[model samples]
Target: MNEPLRTLPSIDRLLGHPQVQGLLAQFSREAVVDLARQVVEDARATASQGQPVPSLDTLAQRVARLAEHRWRAGPRRVINATGVVLHTNLGRAPLSADALHAMQEVALGYSDLEMDVEEGERGSRQEHVRYLLCALTGAEDALVVNNNASAVLLGLAALARGKEVIVSRGEAVEIGGGFRIPDVLRQSGATLVEVGTTNRTYLSDYENALTPNTSAILRVHRSNFRLLGFTHEPPLGDLVALGHSKGVPVLHDLGSGCLLDTAAFGLAHEPMPQESIRAGADLVFFSGDKLLGAPQAGIVVGKRSLVRMLARHPLARAVRIDKVSLAGLSATLLHYLKGEAVAKIPIWQMLSRPLEGLHQTAHKWQEAIGPRAQVRKGESTIGGGSLPGETLPTWLVALSAEGVPGGAKELARRLRSHTPPVIARIQEEQVVLDPRTVLPDEEQALLAAVRWALGA
Candidate 1:
């Protein structure tokens, strides 16, 4: 074998060179040596490969690229395009600007995270959002955790572990990430007492299933599906009464938690936590991010005794939310506390944005770049996993080339590649822009994306 060419300079020699020394001076002493060595090694490696070795300036450029990458912040932001509102992949539920502002105010350099500033005494972090949740949901007491699933888990662990939790077979579900009811119960040390058939469960079925071993009448909402005709289940109020009569608490897991009566927004009815409490549920658990338009949290609200029990659970601390989440959630709840700014919640705003308004927005988008694209009336979805069958009325803008056979693919690929990329759907051979998740101010950038996506 040929002897290895000795073009590589020692770290001392490289830094001693006048040109290298100039570049070294730009960096701190420790970093300068390391950066200088990397540059010289890269140059030698190229020469050994029979390629013309790069000059010091070119090496500097290469080093600059590596340095830039090293310093760049990560877990970088991505455009949400999958059309799932509460798109878990893209970090579900974008917080309102006010919520973001509130988080910024308290996220760094703590203020009163757990201190009664008014009394100058230590307070509980849970106290921050307790009153807000109770006020919003009309509950006797409330507590929040990192997520609704955590709230459910803690509740089960605290109340029903080692005892039976009676639920409808049809209502047992695995939400999002393969988190099944049975799995959760097993982990919580609770026994699963599944009652009734998947399609038909009755009040009597629930009543007969209750025994001395039953700790709670657990009613899990069939969030992912709905039963049509010939379905019979006990009303929530009746179930609550039955559980009370049996001397057991009634626990309802309103999974895919919704706060507002979605029916008013032209969607199916999702049981509100407050409604569950009002209907006499001893404990109610739901997600804060879903319909509440709050930060990612699992809110538990019901009788004060149950709430206290949940808060005292050892597992509750493990699933507890951070101070930032509490601050953001508090700000969001404050909007609801005022009782007038419910419309300001981002999720509610997106849900209640009228079809006419979407069409108008589409028209504006089309007007800006319609000559190079197309606009069509289409429907978006209430993604996240709620309202599976209901297709929200929406508007779409499509763009195509001059008879390019795979224009949709070409446009989609380019849009996904763009900085601050655009996400849309491909339907009937056209790229469709759904306005459901697109903010009003983002319309201009969206229009620009259509143009860029098509290379127009």
Candidate 2:
């Protein structure tokens, strides 16, 4: 054996060290013992490779770190400095205070999640948010599932399975995470009948595609991307009219589920579920988290009979929303019903933040981050498969890597390594943090993380 290998401390000896002992208290003894063994094995390998064996204290620290990496609960809270409001990777849509409180209230104790307190009988979980959805979207009834994808699958499986569903060639899109319309239709046992050109699909194209086997006319909103110039698609009302003439139901998939007008925020108008319902869509599907500013869920609001069909389907039970998320979603819808969405919802608040106020915040961040950071004009996007080409003007705190070690990438990485990791973006070889997306309460933490990353 190498001299260093002989000097390497045994797993039992390492476990007795102060750091490893602390780990044992936090984690099970078996887990700690396993980590200790791995640490000793690593030490032995290092020694065999002609490296000096780490001291007992160092080995104990390694065990502690290994345990932390293996056992720590994750999807940790992070500060969004990336300027993307609906960031999919970071869990899109931070809920409002009321929504958070509602989730906590339900999670802390038991509630009548699926019970009729007034009637003293069995009830349904969907009843919790059904009325709120109908009142908000002007629909006769509504249903919710785990996500928009599930809602689409359920709708297709229940209404159009073993039948042809007509979709525009241009609207056959792939949403985030590789979930495509064609794939979903296939999974639901529905045949996809594509009509019209990719950039131009007229009412006639849809009519031409209609047949005796056509179960539904599916109109998917191009929420994530846009075909600039020379793009022409039939209106929702036109599609609805055509479907009615053919005695087929029109299903509108409005992917962002925007309740408010985006034009008010200086962006292109996104299709809303209410507008689709008012236009005579039989089933309008959308997401709860994106523009609705709630928990992750799929919302379907339309005719009562159609919604009931989806609810009664076998897949509905498999994809129903949970109690906690249902509670949070109910609270979020209340914000919309009360007409306080802009004031209460986090995403709306971020969207409505004034340009001047953003500039001031960027300057404040620059002040805290020292002279290396500079306030510059930049654009913040509404990401997460909503408003693909839309961007909102904002200011950014830009930090150049001229004097920093390892340049911009390294500086950004160091910021991400901080506690409550700060997510930023790099543009033109400089790390930029947009104040638009960062919550007001996270300002201090953002400043501290920037300072640490810059080694100020």
Candidate 3:
């Protein structure tokens, strides 16, 4: 046992090996040395336990494989094939090319991020996209924060702290990760006053809840889920009227930000920020990453005085978005302004893509992959908690192979292990990929990944 341990290769010897020299070209010397040490230690431990020691050549191969795994494990791009667009687990929304370019440009060098070039003085970073948001949403002013949750916290803290905020019990919904509206209101230091019953909330309920302690009327959209039977809630116009009757402001938290009328694309209409503004919401807030097809941001747009009040709050500084997010958001808003969102934003493109084209692409994938795959009609959904239970007509390429080693489950796992990992759905004992979610150029990569997954 001692003799085999002594025969184990030294760190210096392994570093100078020809196989390791190749790894040195791709990785730093320090990283290679660290991996070599780990492999050699494993071999020595085996030898000390009176087991057969791996040969130097075998250990060298292990070192190389381990190094490659480490190099490739950090944030590689993944192809979404789960039929869930805006998949929250898969980074929610993919940014447009313009947004990516803008982020890159700002990351490489400094810009007028916080500098007013004309006045030659310091300025607010929020101004970068403030005007654009105001213009697009038709709001008096606009502000942005890290996310929708944070925006709610900031808004409540800024305007309603130490006062009661009246909300409809039906609208106080709990979404993913145990986040509840009542919990957020508690953290904001505001007293929550529930107005109506869970399934039915009438305008009179809101009207009766108003008091001298009431600071604002909080109306939260039930974005993640909905109740169909015997559900009633007051309209925004009516809520605004009641708030004004009591001299209180109305705050609307429109979870997913949608600018385009989704009806034109044959999808259900999602509430837009502009609609909330036009409906007399004193302050309107929504998310940038959802229907907007931009980066993660919490956008607050509405009455100039309310927005300014939120901006001046100390909590605003804590939840403000970074420069990169601002840059990406500004560029994404420009797409809406230029009337090219349907062509440039990936989410809109996928939503509006014709089923006929998707079928054609699925057929081509089926042909390229040979008999191991078959094209079939399937349903795709707009995920990320938007448009729940609604699906779009789409096509899928399903894997059909006999005697698969680990069956569909194993094959699905292996596909995710492929380079740039191909994510797919399992339906009726077959792995399926929707062409609508897969980009045109990524079809080749998807095919190769599928082949590798099937062991063909």
Candidate 4:
């Protein structure tokens, strides 16, 4: 054996170390043993490569770190200093307090998820949120699935399988994560018949595309992107009229699921499910998390017969929402029904924050972060594939990297590595933290994390 390899500690010896013992107390014995073996194997490989193996203490510490990393339950809580409300990568749309409480209540104990307490019979989990959805969207009925993609898949499979679904060429887009409309249609066993140009599609385009095999007319809202200047597409009501005239149902995919009017908040108007239903769309689909500010879910609201058909489909069972998410969604909808969404939902609260308040918050952060940080004007976007190119004016606490070890990128990395990771953005080589997206209660922690990242 090589001298360095011979110096490697045995797995048994490493497992007996204090740090490894700490790991064992926190995790399973089998898991810790496996990690220790992995660490020792890594050290042996390093020694074989003509590199010195770490000491026994270092090896044991490595095992502990590996165990902690492997065992820590994740999708962990993070502070969003990035100013991107509805950040898809960070688990979009921080849940409202009511929604979080509802999730906790259901997760902590047994829920009547599929039980009919009033009649002493088996029931459906969908019943919890169906009525609330209908009440909120003014639909005759409603159905929910795991997410917007699954909802689209279920709707297409149940309604248009083995038939032709007509969609505008402009609306057949690929949103974030490569979720293409044509791909989804093909997956649902439906044929996609594209009509008209990408920048302009008229009511005549739909009228000309109608055929005996036409199953449905799909209207996908361009929620994530916009075509400016020369863009023209028939309105929802026009398409609805055309569909009804030909006895074909119109299915509107309002991706962002905005319940409130965006224009009221100084943003361009985003299509709403209630407006679609009001415009005679047979069914309207939307996401629960994005602009709706709820848990991740795909919600469908429309005519009773259509919703009933969707509920009865086999795909419905496969894509049904879980009990915890259903509880959260229910509480979120109640915030809307009670007219308390602006005050209760986190995203809405962030959106409604006045510019003056944001400036004040940024100034406070700058004061706390010392001389290297300064208050600067910035913009906060409504991310998560909603309201593309729309930004809200805000103030940012910008930290310059002058004299710092590895510059702005390193500072941002250090902040992310901190406990309860802080997510910020870089602009002009400065680490910029937006006060708009950070929750009010997380201010102190954010300040501390920034201080640590700056090595103050």
Candidate 5:
């Protein structure tokens, strides 16, 4: 075998590449010089240690790797492949086109964030969403924070800190990313008094737990899971009555609070906030980013007194949202005001995309590249750690090996590695192209990826 000859380019020469310059901003001058020194040290150290030193060109690659360590944005865009819309991994629900438009308008310029234009004086940021939220949810008042967790924290801290909070053991949930109920309680300085078994908690159980020291009853939605056999939980109305009779308010934390009950549209039913309020929940906390299909925000809506108390809490300042979140959320609530919530929310649009329409989309992909692919039906998920058991009906295209086995995995890898990666599910040794999440224009790319992976 002939010994391989190597041509080593100089470090200074290799830095001239555009890619290197693109990443150099990630590191400071001193850091860049230090990274360069390491490269030289390693190359020299390998020579002295009787090892084949990597060439100077290879050394430049090493410096680039080092630069990524010092500076990189934490978030990256990924295609939601696993047939999951609102994928928690993919940053949950996507913003609606209307919401995005609002974001662009606000994000691009200075707007009256804290100014009352009509009054010609400084104003509260809360006004933007308060009336809209109240109008949509039938609440006397409303407040928007950074996320649901913060909303819950502010409510609990304001209402129950230095007091006891009675809760059903079953509703004491620990959901995605290890966000436990007990932890939120601890941080809020509210003591949790478990009332009943994890599977069953009655109205009496909550009544017995309440006392003068009890400031509130906390009801959490068991949205992620449903209990089957031997299941019994008190209705919200009954629980509210019991708490109010004892001069304590009831707070319900609805994890995936829907603006509309999706089952009405032929999907699994998610409880809406209006229903919860009408059920007499004294205060309600819900996620703005989940089923609502807006920006990441936690909305608290309830009786004006309780909302006012929450607004005064010191923790509310810490959990306050920025102008952009307020902008996006206010616009989302306006859609609700116009009775356009479902049609304007992106996550809802994907969820409510008719099966017939999905079939047509899959058929379009099939026709777009006739005979080069196979389109079929598959189920998609409403992810974001919201709905786990329920799989929404969707249509898909199944791309398999032209003449080879195990082609699905190869196709998956190719889609994931493409420019602006395409995420698709793999099932039964075939690459499943879910039309539920893919934009119509991207069908060409999807077909191209499938055919390329099939080696067509």
Candidate 6:
């Protein structure tokens, strides 16, 4: 073993090899050295185990394989075969073509992200989309943050820090990724004053909770789950009136933001930002990625004074949205202004797509993949904690390989590892793909990937 360990090539010798040198054009010298170190470590470990030491040529092959793996491990695109629209793990919202183009335009060059072009002076980055958001949501002013959680944190810290913030016990919820209202308030330096029981809350409860130290009343929408059969909560107008009467602001965090009336698409009606603004809520926060169908952003819209206070807060600078997200969000909002969001945005398109269209897609996939694939009626969800207990009827192309080695799991792995990976769900020992979320242009590639997976 010691004899084979001596055969291991030195670091400088490996770095000078043709293959390693070729990698330098694509990867940094430091990165190449790091990868070379990993390969040498692995070979040394094998030799220590009394296994045959790999030759220099074999180590060079290892370097090539390792380099490619590192590249592939970085962010790469994958087809969303899983029916969870707005899939959190899949980067939440897929950008519209216009949004992608807008990001590219800004990313390639600079175009006054935080400068007033006409005035030739430094300006606010929020100006890029502030007017558009205000026009769409009917807010007096709007502010953009990195995400919804940050929006809430900044709002509380600006308005209620060192004061009591009243919230219903029922709305003191822990959202996805363990983000809780009470925890956020704690971070904002605001004291959380819970009112009423977990099942019910009344306007009287909030009124009773208000003190001279109370600065704001917080209303959190239950976006991820529902409390039915006896849940009673104060309406936004009622809370706004109560807060205003006490000289306190009301901040409503509508976790999943919806610009349109979802009931128009036969889905449950979620609270819209415009409705909150109209109802006189002093401040409102919502997510840009969820139902808004844009990049990951948290938008704060409300009375101009309240929003201005938030913008001036020191935390606002720490949680502001980046230029790429700002550009994408601006482009997405433009679709609503043009009265074409339902037809233009991918999330809205999938939500409003006719059942007949999905069935047609499932049939096409079934035909292309042969008997191994079955076209069946299935259900897709408006995932990302937007609409709970409401499922969109979808059609699925289900694949089965019961007799094959490793069965359905092996088939799924092959498709996942395919070039431009195809991600699907497994149910009842079969791989299921809901075409409702798949783009029509991706059909051929999906079929080829499936055929390869099943050895058809």
Backbone Cα, N, C clashes tallied per candidate: 2, 0, 0, 0, 1, 0
Cα RMSD to the true fold for all candidates: 4.8, 1.9, 3.2, 1.4, 3.9, 2.2
Residue 20 in model 3: lDDT: 93
Residue pairs whose backbone atoms clash in candidate 3 = none
Which of the predicted structures, 2 or 4, would earn the higher lDDT when compared with the native?
A: 2
TM-score winner among the candidates? 4
lDDT of 1 by residue, 243-330 (tens): 8987899999987776667898888787778888889999898887776777888889899988899889899889999989989988
My TM-score estimates for the predictions, one after another, are 0.84, 0.95, 0.89, 0.97, 0.88, 0.93
User: Model 6: runs farther than 4 Å from truth?
Assistant: 1-21, 46-61, 72-74
Candidate 4 has a TM-score of 0.97
lDDT score for residue 148 of model 6: 96
Point out the higher-scoring one by TM-score: 3 or 4: 4
**Candidate 2 — worst ten consecutive residues by lDDT sum?**
1-10
- Candidate ranking under TM-score, highest first, comes to 4, 2, 6, 3, 5, 1
Candidate 3's TM-score reads 0.89
Tens digit of per-residue lDDT, candidate 6, span 115-207: 988999999999988999999999999999999999999999999889999989999999889888899999999999999999999999999
* Model 1 misplacement above 4 A: 1-84, 401-406
lDDT of 1 at 265: 82
- lDDT for position 60 in model 5: 76
- The lDDT values for all models are 0.78, 0.92, 0.89, 0.91, 0.79, 0.91
Error of 2 at 168 (Å): 1.7
